[model samples]
Target: MHLILTGATGLVGSGVLHAMLTTPTVSKISILSRRPVPMAEGHAKAHVIIHKDYTNYPSELMQQLRDADGCVWAQGISQNKVGKELKRNREYIEITHTYPLLFARALAASTAPKPVTFIYVSGEGATTSPGRFTPIFGVTKGRTETDLLALSKEAGSNLRAISLRPGGVDPTHHKEIAGFYPQRTGIEGIGGLILPVLRTVYSAMVSPTRDLGRVLTELAMGDGAPLSGRGVEGEGRTVTNVGMRRLAGL
Candidate 1:
């Protein structure tokens, strides 16, 4: 299968990239990033595309993406990174909602013979409900999920969209890949220690980075039963961390 991946430099994206590169079934991988990906280097199947703009896809880029069978969208930013409230909200909406939606819409309009699956790496607390205390991150991500699912329904057999909502993604499970990024410190460092305990006592609260990557790859390759509505009814299109663990057989 040919696949397109975004945010290949991030922890989650790096894990997914590793899974894709190692899997024999995945024949080609198109990596979209602002800069070159180190892990993709020297890999024969990896194709790095330096795309500065996510909201706009040039015709040439669209043509290349049209040939792919699926996309694993891992692009996102932490709310704490963007300074000030106004700028943070704007950047969050653009990155979390606008970018992936534009890409999905473009692919849904394609005339490819086979169906294109889009796996969105969403978080656990994302919700569409409006509230006075709701965070902008949750609102944008929830809206994105709803819009992507609606688009999939409209596109029917041509496009399929699935959202994986994971909480506290632990990167320590795959040190070989996670080592590429800087070590977590402060609150993140503390969370890392507690994540393993959560995995054993309450698995839904956390997911190993490797497991998340493998499950995303499985969904992208259309090799899992969950893609066929075998999971819980009404929520098959959206899988929780618990479901992800089950699919990954962890």
Candidate 2:
């Protein structure tokens, strides 16, 4: 399958890139990033496209995306970054919400690929129902989710948009967190005791980055694999971390 990947430099995106590279079923990969992806080099099927802006894509780049079967949009900013900074909020919203929607629209318009799959990496805290009490981050992301779902429901549209609400994704170095359930003790030891306890607590809600990547890639592939039709209107489109872990066989 031909795939288009964004945010290859991020923690989860890097793992997704690794999974895609190793997966024999993937025939071609197109990476869109501001800077070239370091790991993409030397891979025959990998094409790294450098672009300063995601909002305005050149015709050539759009042409390449037109031929791809699916896209994995992992591009996003941290909640802190999106919330604390005013300038960054606007910039990030444009990048996170507007750009991906534009890309999906262009992909949907392309006729070369009959059907296109889009998997968006969203946070588990996102909620469509919001009020004065809701956090701004969740509200912003939830709005994006609503728009993407609306896009999926477009009349006779060939785009399948899936939002993945993965919880904390353990970094590569902390991958061991996913392996064991922690045992908390009341007796506090040395200064290092807090770290283990925190890891245990974190592991309960977090998933390994590798596993998240595998699930994202598998869902994007649209093989007779388990994740197909997951984004269809009636079916559950927003996948949580538990669902992601199950899909990744973790």
Candidate 2 TM-score versus the reference: 0.82
TM-score on alpha carbons, each prediction:
0.90, 0.82
Give one digit per residue, the lDDT tens place, for model 1 in 1-250. Answer: 8999998998789889989999999999999999889989899999999999898887888888777888899988766556676554677788888999999888767635567889998887777674777787777778888888887778344778888887888886587695555466766677678887987898767778888888898888883233433232224688877678778776
How many residue pairs clash (N, CA or C atoms closer than 3 angstroms) in each of the candidate models, in the order given?
0, 0
Worst 10 residues of 2 by lDDT: 180-189
What is candidate 2's local distance difference test score?
A: 0.72
Residue 58 of model 2 has an lDDT of: 68
Residue 28 in candidate 2 has what lDDT? 98
After superposition on all C-alphas, the RMSD of every candidate to the true structure, in Å, is: 2.5, 6.5
